[model samples]
Target: MISGPLDHFRSGYVAIVGLPNVGKSTLLNRLLSTHLAAVAPRPQTTRHRILGILNGPGFQAVFLDTPGLLQPKYALQQQMKRQIDLALKDADLVMLVLDASRPDPDRGQVPPMLSGRKVLAVLNKVDLVRDKSSLLSEVDRLNKEGAAEVFMVSALRGGGVEQLKAGVAALLPEGQAFYPPDAVADRPEKFFAAEFVREAVFNLYGEEIPYSTAVVVDEFKERPGRKDYILVTIYIERESQKAILIGRGGMAMKRAGSMARRQIEAFLGRPVYLELRVKVAEAWRNDIRFIRENVYGSDRPSGTA
Candidate 1:
């Protein structure tokens, strides 16, 4: 634990922002010491803003794992951008996670929202770098450019994570804890259930199939002693895509379900009876009403499709 003054209990929101596939979600999970965010090698795997509360002896870090920054290609992508924007606007501190192994580390520009705020530049994937001098030079360049502080860490291997947490704890303002110590994340189990299914799709499929796919939990029933029952609907835009997801003799769907069921069961700490079905939604991503209700939840007002 990152120890600090017990009288000064600090708490604040820290938004993890970066370009796609920069290991933003992976870093969040590492910081929280648990898997609260879904991660994959593909870009744009995280579409929603996930809140992970990290509580230690005298500090609470409310970390927001947001969708990676990207140009809006469709209504769904636009909604994802909205999630990023909202996270930036609400954050007390911004942690910019970057892939340090990239050839042109200077290409990663800081967002306009982080202009005057306390920004922490996190150079992730340090384990991939062969030369330590080059990594130090890149860190110096980033710190000289704008970052208030810079850290080199390998999120996958838990390297330099404790120091990063200590740095964040020092920056956090004194206040009350936003969430209870035991709480890991703010999202419900059903939300993670849907995310687990979607993650499986991304891992199993190839090409544009994962990008066009979305999973919705139709039914989630929990029993006292028996295994929990879950019914999920996988939405796609075309009939051909549906056929590809289902596969010949339903083998592909079976593979996805088997992978997702094991993950969901681990997440919920119970056996899961998962049922999957594919349906063609005919460009549901372009429909504002559907995107608002299904993707971002119905609580927010519908925007232009």
Candidate 2:
């Protein structure tokens, strides 16, 4: 969608809602043509609502990419659930993204929170489905499940994304753009720094290390005629986790920092000097106060964030 001087603009908030690890981040990146959301090979990689604005010719789609819906396992997970709920509350339409490569017994049922809003069931990863007959059957089944429409697309390869975006645009109410014409997102650069670092950790670590970590950007400075300086802290629940994350002589942390800095630089359209550190937050997943204070950057800080 191209943006020109618009006299009839269609704009609305579309919440990307789905189960854990359903490629919601990939779908968001595909829709916006930018890496506004973090992607990893794990559930719950997205913990916050990522708002990505797509300005087409006569439509402005404000996508609220939300945390996956799941049963809360701890305080941090509960907070994540709340973030998803808040996204649902503000959404004018909900796009239920699903992995077509996997079996979903609950595909027909919409969550209670989405009862009133319009829903569009998107069967992603269709490229992985070998049987064309089965894929069509699945679409027919989902269409019967009460979604306004069912779209088949491969978010990884950019297939069928244009049609889905068009379908989404046509449903929106006609109005002026919510954000500026040139704005891609409504967040500070520091926020995305933490997100890229978290994505790096999730990709590099394994065995509980990824889920046990929380990244917080302590200081972000933009220096003229110099690379951007970013100071980030990775909060873990135990000392053993910290040791694993840092590796021997800090090799693991160094690797993660280098990888994250490259991605951050690419996204920011400049150079970056990323410094990574680790701290033990001691069962922060279960500690509500600790999760709220450090993870969300609230008023309270016990020095671990």
RMSD (Å) of each candidate, 1 decimal: 2.9, 4.0
Alpha-carbon lDDT, every model: 0.85, 0.84
Question: Candidate 2: misplaced stretches above 4 Å?
Answer: 1-7, 298-305
Which 10 consecutive residues of model 2 have the lowest summed lDDT?
296-305
Per-residue lDDT over 61-169 for candidate 2, one digit per residue giving the tens place of the 0 to 100 score: 9998888999997888998888777777777788999888887776646666677678888988889989756877767766666678788899999998998888888
Clashing pairs in 1: none
Candidate 2, position 23, lDDT: 90
The stretch of ten residues in a row with the least summed lDDT in candidate 1 is 296-305
- Where is model 1 more than 4 Å wrong at Cα? 1-7, 298-305
What's the lDDT for candidate 2? 0.84
Kindly list the per-residue Cα lDDT of model 1 for residues 1-305, writing each as its tens digit: 34455568889899899989989999998998877788889999999888888887689999988898888989999989998877877788899999988876344556675788889889899999888677777667767768877888999999999989988888788999887889888777889999899999988999989888878899999978988899999999889898899999999999999999998988888898999999988888788877877777722342111
Which is the leading candidate under TM-score? Answer: 1
